[model samples]
Structure formats: structure tokens, C-alpha cells
Target: MMGLRGINRIVIAVRNLEAAKKLYADMLGATFHDAHWTGAPFGIHVSIAWDAGIELCAPMPGREHDSAVSQFLAHKGEGIVTVFFGVDDADVAVSRAISAGYACFHSLDYSQDEMDQHLGGRFCRYQESYVSSADRCGFGVALARIDRKPG
Candidate 1:
């Protein structure tokens, strides 16, 4: 059985990316890096706050209606969308969550193509799986395994 080591990251969905960035920066006194567009496929852009390791995401304008970030914003407004936890092994954690009766609602692994295009040709191996909110007291929780070798 897999266990969550700790929280690795928190994903926040916002309606206005700039406004949210400014707000978080002021509140945390943090600096940020260049924005990353997960592209037309994900229809979102994200800015990572290095100090807090929090990712601020907002849906791309044209795709707002269909993007997951938009959906989250609609459902819960400007707040945390999900929490990603670090695990020893993603596959094992998934199996354990399933065996414990939590359904896997979403799964994402950084693909080679995505790494190449979005990460400036650097490879970052990571897998994340979300357990259904129903099983986690209505809060979305994700388990992730990151091969922190390099990016």
C-alpha cells in the first residue's frame, strides 16, 4: 500500500490570472516565474510562485467554458481547486486508494511531447491521480509521484 508523504503542491483556479497573481504575491511577498501555457489542449495558463510552491491557474479566454479551471472557478469560485500530495509511488498509491474504495476521477502524467514543448525540451517525469471528492469529504485530493532528477 502506498502512503502520502506530504503535500507537494496546491492548485488554485482563478478567473483573472493577473489579479490573482498580484494578490498572492502581495499576501505571500513572493516572486514568480514566467507563465506557462499548458496550451490549447488544457486551455489554461499557470504561474508558479517559487516561495510558496503554489500554482495559480486560469482558463484561456476562448476556451474558458470548456476548461477544467473554468469549471472549477464556476463551481467553487476563486479558491483552491485541488491539493496534490507527494507519494512514494503513484501506481501503488492509486492501487491503495482504489482498494480503499476511492475512485480515481482524473489522472495526468507529464508527456514527452508536453515536456519538450512547454519545458524547453527538458524532461520531467511525474504522474498524478485524483481520488473522487465524494471519498475525501468533498475535497479533491491528488496523489503524485515525481522523479525529481531534473526538469
Candidate 2:
């Protein structure tokens, strides 16, 4: 069985990233540790507060009219868009989740080297799988297999 760890991270889609960041900071006293242009294949900006397990995402101006973030914000307003869970094995976790009635939208695997660069030198291999929102209470759920021992 895949070892299912607890909540890994949460991604909130917002219309304005900075405003959302400030709101969260004011409410939770959380500081964002990193900011990046995410939505790689698409277009969006993301701010991450790793300590608080929060990721705030917003559409890039003029470039995101058709991006998923923009569509989500247009439909749902600012709200939780995705949640991630830490797992020992992404394949097994995804299989289990599918058996439990969840539908996987897609999955990806990242080697240690790729992840290191993506994470700014945090070296770890991992696999990630996304379960569609339609299958999980109208919010996307993702499983991540991080190369780390559970504490």
C-alpha cells in the first residue's frame, strides 16, 4: 500500500495574486517565501508560502484570458483550486484512489535533477497525480510521491 501522508499543499486561485497574498498574510501571519511564473504550459503567476502550505495563483495580465486560472476565477471567484497530498508511491496512491472512486485527470514524474532545479536545489525525485475536481467534491486533489522519509 502506498503510504499516504497528510496534506502537502493547497493552491488557491485568485484574481489578484498580491492582494490574495496580503489577505492571507494578514489573516494567518504567513509570509510568502517564493514567487514564480507558474502555469508552465499555460500562463499564471504563483506565490508560495511553504511554511503555511499555501500557494496563491493568479492569471498573468493580458496573457491569461483563456488560461485555466482565469476561467476558474471567472466561474468560482477566489477560492481553493487544488489540494495536494504527500504519498510514498504516487502510482499506488493513484490506483487506490481510483479504486475508491476517484478519477485521475493526469500524472507526472520528475527526476531528482529536474526537481532540484524546479525547487531551487531541493533535491528529491517525486511523482504527482491529479484527481479531477468532478471526482473530488468540486476541488482538484493531487497526490505527490516525494523522496523523503515520513517523520
Candidate 3:
């Protein structure tokens, strides 16, 4: 069993990251970090607006066809791709989700060192698992556990 804290963030797949960020900022009065984050493994460029709990993602250049963001845009055309739930343990959440008959399609684990190098020590450990419940729930779900360093 896993205790889900709350909605961590809602990821939106978009054709243009900049335009989407601007749109979200204007619409929701959101503020996003100036520096964009790239998930090379997923082949997507990501931008997160912490205050609004929104994340915008787009396919990376030259990896458009192979990226999940691109595929989602091609099929659905810029919409909510995944809603992430905050959990105490992502692995436990994923296992529970699987036991409940959900299919997990992607997972990632980042260690403290990796987080320090990539995220500037803001986060210590980050783990996530994306579960597909689209057929039943009409949307994708993701479980995540993020450990932030103390200020």
C-alpha cells in the first residue's frame, strides 16, 4: 500500500514549448524558471511552473518522431499527457498500481548525485513511474517521490 500525498504536477504535451509556457503564464499567472530542462532519455524539453503546478513538454529537435511528446501531439494535439501524484515511495506506488491492474510504461530513478549535478542540489532523490490507465480513466497517471534538500 502507498500513501499518495496529492497532485504533484500536470504535464501537458505541446508542439511548441515556448509558446505553451507563455500561454500558461498568461492564462494562469504562472511563473516558470528561465532555464529549460531536457530529458535526453525521453527526448523531450521540459519547463515547469512550480507555483501553478504545471509542466509543459515538447519534443527535442531531431528526435521529434521518436519522442513521446511528439507522438502525443501527433495523435492528440497539445493536451494533458500525464498527471503526477506525489507519493512517499514511487516504487511502492507503482507496484500497487500494477497490482491494481494498471500498466506502467515508463519509470525513472535519479540519485542524489545525479540530482545535484542536474538540478543544482534542489532535489536529492527523484523517482517516478508512469502508469497508463487511459482506457479506463481517459488519462495517464504517474507516481513520483521527490526528496528535496533542506534549505
User: What is the TM-score (0 to 1) of candidate 1?
Assistant: 0.78
| TM-score order of candidates, top first | 3, 2, 1
Q: Model 2 off-target regions past 4 Å? A: 33-38, 148-151
Model 3 scores worst on lDDT over the 10 consecutive residues at 32-41
- lDDT of each residue in 1-151, candidate 2, tens digit only: 7888999889998888788889989999887855563464567787887668898888878756776688788877888889999988788898898898888887888766666666655436677898875444788898987664234
lDDT (Cα) of model 1: 0.76
Residue clash pairs of candidate 1: none
Q: What is the lDDT of residue 102 in candidate 3?
A: 92
Number of the predicted model whose lDDT against the real structure is largest: 3
* lDDT of candidate 1 over 25-112, digit per residue (tens): 8998867654556534688878776468687888888877888677677777888877878898899999888888889987888887
1-151: candidate 3 lDDT, tens digit per residue: 5888899899888888889888999999998763344466788888888789888888888878998677678888889988989999888898899999998998889877777776667787789988988778767898999867788
Candidate achieving the largest TM-score = 3
Relative to the unseen true structure, what is the Cα RMSD of model 1? 3.0
